[model samples]
Target: MARFTHSNKHTYTGTLLLLSCLALIGAALIADFMLASSSYSPAYLSIASKWAREKSGFIVVPNLNASKVGQKESMAVKDKAERIPERSLSATFADLPAPELEWEQMPSAPVPRLDGAAIQIKNLFYVFAGYGTLDYVHSHVDVYNFSDNKWVDRFDMPKEMAHSHLGVVSDGRYIYVVSGQYGPQCRGPTARTFVLDTKMRKWRSMPPLPAPRYSPATQLWRGRLHVMGGSKENRHTPGLEHWSIAVKDGKALEKEWRTEISIPRGGPHRACIVIKDRLFVIGGQEGDFMAKPGSPIFKCSRRHEVVYADVYMLDEEMKWKTLPPMPKPNSHIECAWVIVNNSIIITGGTTEKHPVTKRMILVGEVFQFHLDSLTWSVIGKLPYRVKTTLTGFWDGWLYFTSGQRDRGPDNPQPRKVIGEMWRTKLHL
Candidate 1:
């Protein structure tokens, strides 16, 4: 408003430029205010409609009052609590059970002997008369004391009966030895019967068996020595007849041998055990069978002999009843059988039957038969192939003495003998 002198041209131009910049800034602020107010103002209707249509797909609809993350976390926690029940989880964990079987290996026996006469008198296991080697039979008696876990030398068996295949039974105080073979395969069997007074460590002669037999299944039942199936002439020809002799005054009485029912199929190498006053006879070798007339294999071969897997039960009424047979054929050729936990266990036997060969396959498969269910299951197996092995049960352990091992598959070789003794404890 004050009166001013005339300025330079440059000063005038600078003032004009500053005014122009101010005007542009004012216009920009007015445009921003108008656009911001367009949501409610009627003047910007067209522009607002176009912007809403274009930005509809890209619009972010946000919940201002409630946080999205917090809502999701709350829903997850509620669903988990509703789905999972505490009582159900607790019951599931509580119903779980523990395992059943456990086996423990124990100390070994002193010497290696197969087909030995083994009987338990008190806590001592008497092992007598067995095949020591392929060429020799043993007469020395070894007593294993379970209390001390050591072996003691007992009186050797009589010199005349250095034998194997002896049928042995115990009367707690005395052990009775029945028919046996003097030597190995094909050797003639002896009928000489003897009783060993364990307390006196002496052997005394008794009335012998009516005829010589080997591997007879012998059992002392009701004051009588019962003898059953065994080889009379050879391993192939098994004696089917059954005989029993009464015992009195710790000796075989003057009573002659009485006859009982004979075996249905003759199998000399049979395994017999007494359960619940009944006798169970298990697998053995039942000779051979002829080939069928119209079979392809029969056209080439006339006869093929198979091993036996038969099972029979003898009741107290002198009656014989057939039972379920073994799952596999057993050519015990030589084996050991025992009863544990109400189950009949058979070990160290072969199943193979060659139509033409002198060689026999050996196995260590341990098979167990459950009396209740009458089913067979494999419990465990021996480390090495075993045949003609001696077995004893004491405390809770099963002792396996020396037996024959298989030589490599070279048709036929002398079976290797094992000196190692193994024992396994059965955990209930």
Candidate 2:
């Protein structure tokens, strides 16, 4: 009986040793497979390297040589500003006739206001969400039909987003309203983002912006919504941060906010437009308005602020190239800017304070920049001096409406506001 019990114990000890050896062999095989895969596969090496970098707090700079190939292929961008024509920065209006344009008067808008954004999509012009008389902020949406040539009150905005100064961009179907100011009294900024579907005429909330801002030069580029240059609280606090949101199938993707390098100062009220693969940032105000003797409320500056005459172009490589400054600095306000007939047309903006009166004067000047020639020329002037006019371009017509007229001492509003809608066939 003793001998049989001893035999059973030996058998149990042998089985335990075999199981332990098998476990170690399995672990060894797994370790070998992992090491082999990582050493042989580029993808595995990349993922492991990324993980290591994240854990080690080390950043690996991309190889510039490898990136250039992808950049040239993906963007198909043109060369730098060296390609532009070398000519006099200022164009002369000596022989240029009044631009070949046909003027037409449209029906009055239900709400006569300024500081509102006008965007045209498929022949329909949507205009509203600006301050009215007596400092009244509007939430109503007013749409104008080109075929019918009439204005219709469509619907109210989801919230009070008046005087935002921020503009809207479209992806052929959805119109995105970016962050803007909500305070009607102080003209403060807010970080509210929304989108409106023209088909349904409904506004839906999207992710809010990283910071509150107003008057941002926003646009759609390369399937992303690029929000650049504005102000945080007032025009003084220039928004230096650049953010982009990737939208897929009319919806902003989750966790898609990308922060790029900061732009130059004086970003507010700047005219930003994407031509081909380059983004052109034109005149803007460097400083903001401050209180002065006799003028207690908000009003235009008195020749104290710096108006940017410098034209900055952002290339496909994300580098900014300085172009020849405009002959006349037309910053501090939004100029009538449009790209047409391979030319850039800007007109009717307030210039620096009049040399004599020390008061900023409304301008009636019109200028054109030829893309092919890379030259600028004076294209005569508008029929009337105008500034801060809500403007848009569709097909071949440039639409402008309801700008503030110069106010005299008797006027109650700081500036006299208008409500007229005018359209003209712009010869590019």
Candidate 3:
């Protein structure tokens, strides 16, 4: 094994050098094994699993980031998965020096902004684009170097990306961003793509999305970046067109936009992730509940709210199937996910009446999904129930910040916009 010093204070554990080499082996072996056994491919997965054992940590969790996201049970006739052990994972949110959230006075963003965002990388937090009240995507990028307990402005996103369909993922090198919205109010057609080099402070353009969609939760699977559901033309008619682009040489491509198997016409803004070789999508706005076994995407549209406990998964053959469903119907939260102890650990998102609601509401909550049995249940709740704009997990503890809550229709109601703050761990 070879070791090299990374500028970031956190130690890399000497495994990153061979990460790509091992990933290539895993991909190749898995592909071959799939060819031999159409339906079953264990031996190929074994090779990939072996390579993953050594290098997955470097690629998956390179540093500490703040973000956060689940499912239910089923035991029907043949080929049904068994009951998963209902787990209540006690979270471990580390306490920060300063306390921000309050019930009386409105908490303010470290910087006055909403929709502007943050990301954690190499043991630090980076805040970027969010729209101002006048509706302009800020070009300045503010980074919270948690290690040094200070804020630093590194580099702005490729261009102005405000109210855009934001999706970001990192491979410990480049911070790949997909965000673009056009028009006067930013509620227009947007098609833009950019890649930021965290080290060199550079940005590059790539192929844009086939359509101008926003607010879709993105999932990275097997070296390819997948953009999940988000609404485009008609907010009510959410697009199930799943778009993906291959990334190579520190660049994310916009071309080769393949709209594979559409989701169950279950609407958009659902929490999406690929776990254990299966893609799991949770919750969305305005979709049917009573979907028959082999029904099309838009099966039931009578329901008012598209949100539901419905959790869908795509098998190896790319067939969409529903899972046990969630504890309740939830949509439009800062739903990011991280795996802990073989369970999906989901953290803070706005589960209230509105994402920008300023009034006090208990939307800050956490839950888990046990892959083995695949059941859903609440684990713990955030100490302060606030609808944060964004969430991500890194290093161990979960971090969330930078979103507005309803201030209510009143006189001089101040909306709280957090620049960057971490969880106060109510009861981890």
Candidate 4:
């Protein structure tokens, strides 16, 4: 029996040794398989390199050589400023008639006021959320039918006297109203952000801005909405920062406004246009306005009325460059801007101050800056002493309206805001 037990023990030891050797061999095979699988795949290298990674549910890959593309530092200047033909201010007076355009009057809005905003969508004109004397700025949203020269009252602004100077942007389905003033007094600012769902025909709260502010300029970039150049104190600031907001899966996300390389000291009232992914800040008050004896409220040349004659470009590199200057000085130009035929055309805005009130002048003149040429030339203007601010389009016709008309001291028309619509066409 002792002899049998010794033999059995030897057999069991040999079996155990065999099993351990087999297990090691299997493990070594698996290790080699994993190493080969990872090494042979170039796609897995994409996961390893973080530089080209973009994962916001969009899963877009950044161009790996984008940084290597040396910047085109300098551009040959092509555009030049020409003489201001006297025909611009009095085009309809048979002075400077554009060969393609025949100027005439259009029906007016129901109410007479300035500072109102009008937006065009799918061939319909939606004018709303502006402020003027009817006690305080208006809350009533008016819709004008250019086809029939009729008016319809839609939804009133959620709040009152929110003389909102901000523009609206939409994806053809949802219209987003950005930041502006809420209280009758500009002292009280509003950070409210509202979105109107055209499909639902209802208002929904997306997100409120970080602070109550007005004149928040917004544009869409790389599928994200970017807003820049606004006020914290209702005047010029070294603090006019740039911010970006994004919408994903129908939910909105915002980043804090970051000071982006200090944009030139352009006023919030400046005319800004985004052409070819570049932000052009043109035609605005240059100096910051603070309420005081020599502030912008005072209209002093160095203090309040520093007109922006040069065009500043914020290119894709996010750098600022001074472009060609306008022929004449321009400021407080009411809606002195209009975008037509892929070119930014600017018309009547006050180039001079009022002799008596010392306020910004109400000049009826026009200019066109061809984006490709980066040059300027005087265009067409209205015949009468036209005032402006709210400028937009309707019924295939360019319409201008809602500006402050200059009234003499005895005019008592201090609040005599005018709301007239002048319709014209953009000659190619």
- Model 1 worst lDDT run, 10 consecutive residues: 87-96
Question: 1-428 in candidate 3: lDDT tens per residue?
Answer: 55456674255544553677798989866764543333222432332233223211211121112111001222243433322111111121111122333222222335645544455677666666665553354666667654554555555554445343356666667766664343223344356766777788888877877876655656666667777666664334466678778787677544567676777854554566666788788765653223323544323222334344467888788788877755444555534455566777665443312212222232444667778878754666544544434554545555566655434322112255545455432222
Looking at candidate 1, what is the lDDT of residue 428? 39
**What is the per-residue lDDT of model 4 for residues 349-414, given as tens digits with 9 covering 90 to 100?**
555343234444454556677787777665665533344456665545676666665443222122
Query: Could you tell me the lDDT of residue 421 within candidate 1?
Result: 61
Task: Indicate the TM-score of model 2.
Answer: 0.68
Write the residue-wise lDDT of candidate 1 on 1-428 in tens digits: 33445776566678877988999989866764553343232312332232233312212222222222222333546556543232111111101122223334445556677666677776787887777664577777888776676676656788766388778878789888888877643355788888888888888888878888777888877778888887764444667988898986569786578887897766556677777888777877755322344554332222333456678888878788887666455655333766788888776665543322324556555667888877766566565566766666778877666667665432222276665666777653
Better model by TM-score: candidate 2 vs candidate 4: 2
- In model 1, state the lDDT of residue 346: 73
lDDT of 3: 0.52
Residue-pair clashes, model 1: 0
- Candidate 1: regions farther than 4 A off: 1-110, 287-306, 333-335, 354-358, 408-414
Q: Report the CA-based lDDT of candidate 2 relative to the real structure.
A: 0.62
> Candidates sorted by TM-score, descending order?
2, 1, 4, 3
Q: Of 2 and 3, which scores higher on TM-score? A: 2
Q: Write model 2 residue lDDT over 349-374, tens digit each, in one string.
A: 66555322345555555767676765
How far does residue 340 in candidate 2 sit from its true spot (Å)?
A: 1.6
TM for every model, in the order presented, reads: 0.66, 0.68, 0.61, 0.64
Task: Note the clash tally of each candidate.
Answer: 0, 0, 32, 0
Quote the positional error of residue 82 for candidate 1 in Å.
66
